[model samples]
Target chain A: MSAIERQFYHFAFDPASRVVRMALGEKKLDVTEIAVKYWAPTDELLKLNPSGLLPVLVENYEDGQTVVVCENRAILEHLEELPLSPRLWPVPMQERAEARRLVGWFERKFDYEVNALLLYEKMEKRLMGHGAPDINNLRAGRESLRDHLSYFESLLETRNWLAGRSMSYADFVCAAHLSVIDYFDEMNWQKYPHLKTWYMVIKSRPCFRPLLNDILPGVTAAAHYKELDF
Target chain B: MSAIERQFYHFAFDPASRVVRMALGEKKLDVTEIAVKYWAPTDELLKLNPSGLLPVLVENYEDGQTVVVCENRAILEHLEELPLSPRLWPVPMQERAEARRLVGWFERKFDYEVNALLLYEKMEKRLMGHGAPDINNLRAGRESLRDHLSYFESLLETRNWLAGRSMSYADFVCAAHLSVIDYFDEMNWQKYPHLKTWYMVIKSRPCFRPLLNDILPGVTAAAHYKELDF
Candidate 1:
């Protein structure tokens, strides 16, 4: 098999992109990272993806030929299909569907309630000259987090992993988003012991080492960000 | 093989559920329908699905055997795995990924903007006990729809189907969401000729026939809701 050249375009602060980056690292795929600032949308990136979203992968770029893949979940699935990469999805149809479902659950439901609120209310303002934070929305987001966390706790009580018995893309997709929330000192680890334990296991993995060091402008991770047993 | 008993709980107001219903019809699956009003948020249904969402398919009733599938995209994928159902996903890995991505795009991006605005603002007030419409959000959604429509137009211009040359789950997923918005007369068909033409063809299919006759409480579809040439 020939070596594949890949380029990943992502924003520094975006969690979805971060998840894709972590997956790439896990797969040991060499990729060039192009930074994108969401506040200032560029025409070139817009041409590549009209959705105006981050974490797009361009594969086997050779002057005129390139295949653009958008959506972080799709990118992860694409990488898993490659023979060189470590298997990130379970083999059984039931297990694979469950993993994919959890990925979607985090990306859609958790991201909307937690990541979007935190980014727009807390982070985006610092970067984009937006006005004061919407306290009501943020408060509601925080309140909603408790329920979601409890769900995670119950999920963790049954299995060592998020999706199933095996480690899969679902774990990365979730940890990627949660790490962003953790950076803001927003997650209440005490309330979710099982989740905390699961997170620590993920944090210790070599694949997640680089993620702990990611520094965003005007935003600092929690003091225990790098601590595996926080 | 013993006959598999399936029960589908859905609401007329839900476009996602409608897609599942259409797929069931096409596959000729013998399933019983239990109408559910999404706004009520019943504890019974909530027990079945912690998400409290509609379109939950319960398969194999004897001995309490059941599989609860949420997220319309995931549910459709699960249905494809059933023994007697017609396959909606492509055989090739790349093509399947493309189809799934389009399904996600329609469900998350397009539905979030278009259906959320049109249904929640214009229709939900009458069905549920929601407050008056937010005109600003509705207008913003309409403006966003123009951008999404243009993307769909470009997509339809290149391929006979939404995801590729063959009709797949992606087409049903998109058409399902669009049909909901079209019922409210939210889509400006003249602005996107290709998408409009493509929608007309999908709407005329036998599987889509029930959707044309669907009636939401206190809300009537637009005058041209059933018109194939519209």
Candidate 2:
């Protein structure tokens, strides 16, 4: 295991990349991080993952064998398979299903509904040299975000974590998406009290430390972005 | 295991639903099928999956225990966890990564690039009464599909399967997406002979039988859709 070296390629603001980074942080595994821009992906990044997606992990073994894992589900599952503590999936069949379901929910629904509108207008456009943000898209994305946040708040009203009592990857998954949104000051912290409290706790974790430290070029973080007590 | 029973809810034309159905078929798991229309989703369907996504599976145990799994990754992972033959993932680490990566590719890339354009204009608009197909969108989707097909054909030129030597779930994933596109006669089969041949071999499998028989209401399948020797 000592001979195995890891290299992770990702964009700092990419929600998908954040999930991998936070998961790796949770697993307490060290890796060499290679930052790439979403607008201008490097040739090496394309060679590794033809899809040109972020957060690709490479595991290099002593025998010259290399495994290039791409996509969130594949990379996360591959990491979970390692002999590591803190199992991501819960014990109960239903909870595990719930966690994965929520993970899919954010990836499928939230990404389309919120990120495509909100994050794209706020973050990606800035990074890509695209002109000023579209007010209509920003408004539409915010409207959709409220609905999604209310749904999560409903779940948090009963359960301690996103999935259930125990903390699962689903929480990290939710935080990764919301944190990037929150970075742009989109979240109305006063409305969702329960989610606000939950966010503060999860946001204060050691794994989340790296995320707060990350500085996105050309974009200024929100006033409370780096604060644990926010 | 005789004390256990299974039920599946799906929409016939849904690519995500077909992936689950095909995987279940390959596992030889008998499930009671419940057809639900996409436009008018039943209350029970929304209750099972809040997202109102198709292909939710429920397993009932003799002890009055029931497990509901929703979404493709969660449901498929749950099914693979069962003690079944014909593993979906290959043994080699790299092959396993490749298989999962391709699955994500179809879900994220193909769904956005092709299905949202081609399938939406062709099948969904008719089902939803959203008017006639848009020729511009169809042309754009076909152009994108050709690019994707060339990539697949390049892979098929070397490897026996989509992921690698073993006929893992990656083949089923690609088949599921392509099957839906082919249903609308969107696929230009002649351009990619290797992919066409690969599709022929997979399309002949017994697991693919139900897909062939499935008829989406108000939409006639392409003439060659059910032909095994096409």
Interface RMSD of 2: 0.9
Tens digits of per-residue lDDT, candidate 2, B120-155, equal 999889888999999999999989999999999999
Those runs of model 1 whose alpha carbons end farther than 4 Å from true positions after fitting are A1-3, A61-65, A84-86, A91-95, A131-138, B1-3, B61-65, B81-86, B91-98, B131-138, B188-191
Q: Write model 2 residue lDDT over A1-230, tens digit each, in one string.
A: 53278999988889999999999999888899999886788999999999998889999988899999997889988887787878888888878889999999988899999999999999888887798999999999999999999999999999999999888889999999999988888989889999999999999999999999888777778899998887
TM-score per candidate, chains pooled? 0.88, 0.96
- Ten-residue stretch with the least lDDT total in model 1 chain B: B61-70
TM-score of 1: 0.88
What does DockQ give for each predicted structure?
0.34, 0.84
